[model samples]
Target: MDQAALRTLIGQLADDLGWLEQHARTQPLHVAQAAELHYAGALVRNVVGPFLEGHAALPLHVAVVGGAGAGKSTIANMLCGAVLAESNPQAGFTRHPVAYAPASGAVNWPSSLGFLGTMQRLSKPEPSSLDADVYQVRRVSEEAGQFGVLDKFLVWDCPDMTTWAATGYVPRLLEVTALADVIVFVASDERYNDEVPTQFLRLLLRSGKMVVVSLMKMREADAPAFVAHFQREVLDKMPARAVATLTVPHLTPAQVVDPCRNAPVYRVPIVNQIFVLGEPVQAARQRTVRSATSYLMSHQQHLLGVARDDLLALEGWRQRVREGQMEFDNRYRREFLTTERFRRFDEALVRLLELLELPGVGRFASLTMDVLRWPYTWTKKLFASAFARPEASSMPERQVLENGLAGWIDHLRKEAASQTGKHPLWEHVQHGFSAGLGNTIKDRFNESFRGFQLSLGDEVERTARKIYEDLEKNPLALNAIRGGKFTAEVTTILVSGGAILYSGGLALPFVAASLAMAPLSASVIQMLTEFFGSQYVDFHREQTRARQQALVAQHISTPMADWLTSWPTTGGSAYERLQSILGRFPHNLQQMEAAVQAAMM
Candidate 1:
């Protein structure tokens, strides 16, 4: 537990807590968790770290805290044995904590670095009503009879907790509270059962600070009953700690002005209680440290819950990304895969058969066959030329791909729009979707699709070339297959012509043309059917389909998926920042926690 090392660790913890506080949005748990983190950091840096470094414990802090107009300043004035703070009649008058130490400055206070967490130290005197993130230290005159009994202690007069303005300066209060070893809780007759101050008391008690409840602005006669009621309603339910409850009778301004001198009899009891709690400074500091650590340990689940909420939000974003990917893939399959004809496949088949022609001898054999069938070939060509229809116009592949991608982008945008208010992630995605995100997606998709299209021709040609290359290795089998294909063509053409002539009618021209070219068309169809049935061709076709599917996925599906998956991390997105901060804060806290525990031991 090197003091410097401990200070460095605590410093980092303070920074992490500050980050949490800044990002705490609207959730109550998130806000409370951030406050708790700040409190923990303050304790480590201001109390534990300084104590370990052998800093003086004599100047033990005693903070008087309560709701607005709860007689907090009166208690501070009484503790100092004089009117050191302004006890105004206005509610929420005290907006910042004012520290009252001995004029002699006998005890050295902890530096501002970790003293009040993020609150700045005001060098010039400022009114307690100055509502800001700051604290000011002022030394009170050291009259022999005033503050003489509590020479080694520093008393802090803190702002009211129940005021709306308190939100702006409550961190200042928590900061002073974290520095305190003892707390003098002031509650007027009206505020005794108030929810806000009671909860604050509970937090203090839970943190293990020594507390003395001064029930103020109550008649002396009703003190007993009030004390009993306060004990039953507040004290009884709180965990056992070193706590004392007393009654401060309502007083006039004159009496409050010089509480110790004018009402010496009334002030003696409160002074005695303070004396009892502040002596043996080492023991008091240890109690504070142990109490803080215990509170942190007990509330570990709460802190973790805060982190879990953040991660759950992140998970929601990831789930949306996956859904978007699925939608994209579905659209591509429906718009592209289902409608695509792959007409190039037919051309590829013919080219593959041409490659299988025998190098020299097979050509001569084929030529002799052509000469014998010259009359049939000539008749088939004449009729085919007369009846051939023009190829039908269709959508270009590029247009189809672009249309499908646009549809997918539009679908995602609509989904985001519909789900905008459902969750934080959705809201973030919705905002981004409207901000040119669709254009970015389109650009990436088009780039990938272009590359895919360029390689498609080569892919089909390669598959056909492979079939021919395999056939060339087995010339005898190739020639036999070719001879059988030729005979099948001639036989089919003759049968088709006989059928057309026997069933003659006014439709003779069209039917006759179709039958005449039946030798070439029917033979090619039969040859392909037989070749596709063979084990080798079947394997090749399967391979080609698989490769084609892979190409589609790589170019289109993969790009869309990648964009959707990574959208949350893109620059300027709220989710990206949330993810980064959430990850870093919790991990740093965990490590700091371990270091703190070891150092304490």
Candidate 2:
């Protein structure tokens, strides 16, 4: 594989993953999914960085690891063909990992860039205990033997898992385990088949780590059968997902002291043969890497699925908002409109016109004549305005209405927040709920009210103007304005004169009737003004509330509910969106895996 090609691929993958991470921050479907994607991406970068640099690289590492006193140091010293560590016969004697590199000193450690999700690089120093956080590199000081194949290898002495702080070290162990092409699982005869080690074996099998199991101090005759049982109960039971397995024969303390001479030594021993002289070792290592890669691929779908689940919840939240809006609508229509403020639509204004019963100019002309009663007009207008109390309807105030609705939506968000714990996706939802609902409600309310007000005000002004024009065109209807003598003459002519004489000569009765009709027409005009004015205002109020309810119901509620409901089935977001996040890791991993295989070749 071209080194440049692989690097390009990895870089592209990193960029894609970074974009997803950013999106997850904004539009997270689920908080748990977001966290999982983030961590997986980090894992990809850690696994891929080493191979992108080409193959004049660090030795393929194999760490001799297990619980304390599991004979890791003995195995480490034996692997190097020299007593490099002090075998104190004490439990947990060798504290830190002591690397055994090729004696040629020509090899270099793998570059620490982009490994283990940006861990701090540790210098090579023998610490008091194998601080699981760090690893040390030591060079093999002996001359090379016939097999130059061992030159490209390094061993790590790791902390024991049976300790109290082992939980913390497990992640550290996984870090190195991922880095290693192979693992040396050291189990003494006393400790073999124990629970902790068995569980560790299962974990290794799951991650596709190659295993070399050393069963120390078994009876020579029992070794074959022991290996068989170990394979059946331990290896065969391994979920049909076993990585690799190898068994080491028994070695007494004396034989361990001089393993080259006393222990069966065809390339060290049958146990050592698996690591040292096996024809299939490289193939087995590749199989393990491939299996691990395949497992990761199977889980990639889940990485995207988590984000999908979170997105689905948004729809449910929106439905709740819609139901609330409908509830408010019912309450407002029934409670607010039933008040006397809206009930006496035209009655009050019609009664006010009754005070002008003395009659007036023409029908609409009374408005002008009423204005003539200037001093008493203020009192009349005051009495007219007081008939129906506007205060009750206006008490809550428009500001209060708007603020209350907004506060209610915010309260809904608070309820959501209380239910969703420590989840980053909920944080995103909270932000969206606050900002989206607030601005949408405010803008909709203001726009609806403004348009309704302008429309109703124009209609009322038109009705008033039309009434004035009609009365201005007629004046015989002003007998009340003529008053006293003119009124009495008309009444006397109508009462005493013959119908025949009163008929053609400015018919007195016709004139009196028209004059009487003046106030009646004015009352009619007042009724029209009051009816339409109040009706127009009420219509607009209902429209405002209705539109607000619609906005909450349709724009916000439905879409949100849909997003939440579809979370599980479609894996949350659309395939393209989820893939955008998942694609990042695989793209990076594919490039690095190919590059590493090529470099080794």
TM-scores for candidates 1 onward, in order: 0.71, 0.55
Number of the predicted model whose lDDT against the real structure is largest:
1
Q: Where does candidate 2 have its weakest 10-residue lDDT segment?
A: 337-346
Q: What lDDT would candidate 1 get against the real structure?
A: 0.71
Q: Which residue ranges in model 2 land beyond 4 Å of their true spot?
A: 1-46, 56-58, 85-88, 116-132, 142-149, 240-250, 265-292, 301-601
Worst 10 residues of 1 by lDDT: 521-530
* Candidate 1, position 367, lDDT: 62
Q: Write the per-residue lDDT of candidate 1 for residues 55-170, one digit (tens) a residue.
A: 76677788999988889988888887778788789999999888887777455866635766667879899988898888888787778337434585788899988987777777
Query: Which residues of candidate 1, in runs, are more than 4 Å off?
Result: 1-16, 25-58, 81-83, 112-114, 117-127, 130-133, 140-149, 206-210, 236-242, 249-283, 286-317, 338-400, 420-434, 450-562
For 18-113, candidate 2 gives per-residue lDDT tens digits of 455555656544542443344444434544444445433345667667765677766665666655555656566554445566656565544533
